[model samples]
Structures are given as structure tokens and as C-alpha cells.
Target: MSRRRSKILVVSALAVLLLAWEGAVVLTGAQASWPFPSGIIRSGFAITADGTLLVALAGSLQRVITGFLVGALVGIPTGIAMGLLPWVNLAMRPVTESLRSIAPIAWIPLAILWLGVQGNAALFVVAYAAVFPFILNAAQAARAVDRNHLRAARALGAGPGLILRAVVVPSTLPTIFTAARIALAIAWSSIIAAELALGVKIESGGRSVAGLGQLMVATLYVKRDVNALVFGMLVIGLVSFLIDAVLRRLRDTLLPWARR
Candidate 1:
């Protein structure tokens, strides 16, 4: 199908889904138990106006950003080193392989035990989630750089630094960015889990240590507020979608030759 037709179809499907949901809610007379699409909108607006949503979003974003940066800073360089040096690869691969096989969420208990229920616990989890993909992808990408390109650059009297900048780094960038996209999603999801699992209690109603995940959990299980739960879920989905869209655009812009 054509792009325009595909988009229309998607929109149509969404509209149908929304309508079906509202119809079900009306038929069941369970507006309080299940949120209609309008309930989600109203809840979102109400929470935003009260500044509850903003605070949670900001706290979550801060942890995710910090964790992602730390993970990338550590993982990318280590991966490059491992890829470029046989000794480094031999030394690091076994440890990395062992650790990578373990799920990031599995470390949540340890993180909470080590760092307590505060922000640091969540940060640790998010960083752990973000690191492995970066390491694996960057190492593979760096290793996959054409040997002939390196030899040619060396033959032309190019230094290691020069060859790395001109050839190795450029060749590896696409894979790195791809890994980054995956890592970002992982980091985002991990932060939510961390926040829900280890969220600190705040005395203030509006100003809480709770992130969206916490809000979602509380709304559903504690408050039994389906509208609020739906709102939180929508916000999460929208933010994730936007971030992924931005990353895709950045990739396309930076790697224009990738299109060919």
C-alpha cells in the first residue's frame, strides 16, 4: 500500500478502537472501572494542571538521561577498545558475556539493597539496561570495519588516530546509533520498573518520588482509578514514540549515505 493509504488505515484503525472501547464502557455501565478515551484525556489534563504529571515526568526523565549517558560513556569506549585490541577482547569478552546473559531487571533487588529505595537504585538499573547493547553492537561494528580500508590508510602514512577518525569511527557509527536506539528503549523501560519497584515515599501529594510507573501502579491497584491509569499509560507511550521518532530522524540526517 501507498504511504498515505497506510497512514489513513492506521488512523482509521485507531479511531475504531477508541470507539469500540467507549461503546463497551457505555454498554457495561462501567465508566468508573474502565476508562473511556475521553476519561483518559480529562485525567491527563487534570494531572497536568495540578503539576503531578510534570513532576513525575521530570524525575523519570532526569534518571533516564543520567543513566543513559553514564552507560554510553562507559560502554562505547570499552567496546571500541575490545574491538580494536585482541588482548582487550580476550580479557573482557568472557566477563561481558556472562553478565549480559543476565537480565537487567534481575539486578533490581540488588540495586535496591545496595542503594536503597532512592533515585540511585533506579539509576543503577537504567544504566545496567542501557550498557550491554552498546557494548555488543559497538564491539561488533568496530571489528567489522574493512581490514582493507585500515591497510590502505596505514599504507598512505595515516596514523592510528587518523585512520580511526576517518574510517573506523565513521564505519561503526551506524551500528552504534542502532544500538543507541535499542539502549534508549531499554533504559526508558528500566527506569519505569525501577521507579515502580523502589519509589520513595513523599509526604506531599503533588510532589512525589513517584514516576509514571508508580503513578500507574497506584492509580490502578491503590486508587482504582482507571482513568488515571490510562492517562499514565498514554503518556508513557507518547513519550517513547516521540523519542524513537527523534532518534530515527537523527540517524537519517547524520547518515544520509545510509539511504543509498
Candidate 2:
């Protein structure tokens, strides 16, 4: 099939599926549980028009970006150092693995106690989520660097720092970068949960920011806003898919040689 026809088919399928959901709602006359598409569009429009959705989305983005930046900065270097120095890896492996096992969500209570329930705790969740990918990817990448490359660097009188910067890091960078994309998605989700759990809002009440989690909560509380919840989920799914597509594009750009 031609590309354009394939795209049309996909869109048509999705439309049919959504309409089927609407039909189900009508046939069952279900309230609260299965609100229809028109209701979802209305809720989405209401939130968007009032700017609650934008503020929530912006706040979420800020928290996600901060955590991802901090996590990458720390995790990459630490992982590289550990990989290069056998003693470091041997000593810290158990602890690192142990902590990694702890879900970032599980840390919410502790994070709130330590950093308060607001922005700091939220950032902490996102950062912790991001760091693992960097660390795991960096460690494996470092350990797997071609032996011949290291030997050649050493023979050229390159010191440890120089070798690490010029040869080792470069060798692992592409793979580490790819893994970072996954970490970023994790970080975004973590921050959203943190914000919702903490009940964060723009300027307290008065419309309030409306994250997907927050939207879900609102649906539960507002006594039959099922449409809002489903729409919010759709928004989250679209955002995530778009992010994955962007990451794929980045991978192609950064590793053009891999394509060959």
C-alpha cells in the first residue's frame, strides 16, 4: 500500500474505534464509568479555555526538565567513573542496584518528609527516575568499549583524564544518549505523579493547574467527569508518543553511522 493510503487507513481505524467507544456509552447509558466522546471534547475544551491545562502542562514540563538535567549530569559521570575504576564499581554496585530497585513513586513519602511536598520533592522524583538509565547505560557502555581503542590511546601517551574525555566517553556517548531518551520519558511521568500527589496548583485553588493525574483525580471527585479523565489520558498518550518519535529522530541524527 502507498504511504498516504496507509496513513488514511490508520486514521480511519482510530476514528472507528473511538466512535465504537461512543456507541458503547450510548448503548449502555452508563454514567460516571463510560462518558462519551462529545463529553470528553467538552471537558477538554473547558479546561483548555480556562488555561488550567496549560499551566499544569507547563509546570510538569519544568519539573521534568530540571530533574532530567540534574540526573544526567550526575549519573553519567558517576557511571563512567565507576566503570573505569574497578574498585569503585565493586564497592558501590550493591548499593546502587538496591536503590535502583526502589521505585521512584515509593519515595514520595520520604521525599515529602525530606524536601517538603511541593516542587523540590517533585523534582527529586523526576531526577531519580532519570538517573538510572544514565548510570546503567554508561556503566555497560564503558565496560564494553573496544579494548584496541584503549590500548592505542595509552600508547599515544594519553593520561587517564585525557583518555576518558577523548576516547572512552566518545565510544559510549551514542549508546548513553539513546538510553537517556528513555530516562527522560520516565522522568516526565515521575514528575507528573509527584505534582499530583503533592496537590500542587497554580496560586492555590482558583481554577488550579490540571495535569493528567490531577484530571483523573478531578474526575473522581467531580461526581461524573469520566470524559475529562479519558481525554486527559489521551493527551498523555499523545505527548508520550510524540516524545518517543522525537527521541528516535535524535538517535538517527546522532548515530548516522549506525544506520549504515
Clashes of each: 0, 0
**Deviating ranges (above 4 Å) for candidate 2:** 1-13, 31-33, 200-212, 222-224
Best by lDDT: 1
Residue 18 accuracy (lDDT) in model 2: 83
lDDT of 1 by residue, 30-60 (tens): 9977789888888889889999888889888
Give the backbone clash total of model 1: 0
RMSD of each: 2.9, 3.1
Candidate 1 local distance difference test against the native: 0.84
Candidate lDDT scores, in order, read 0.84, 0.79
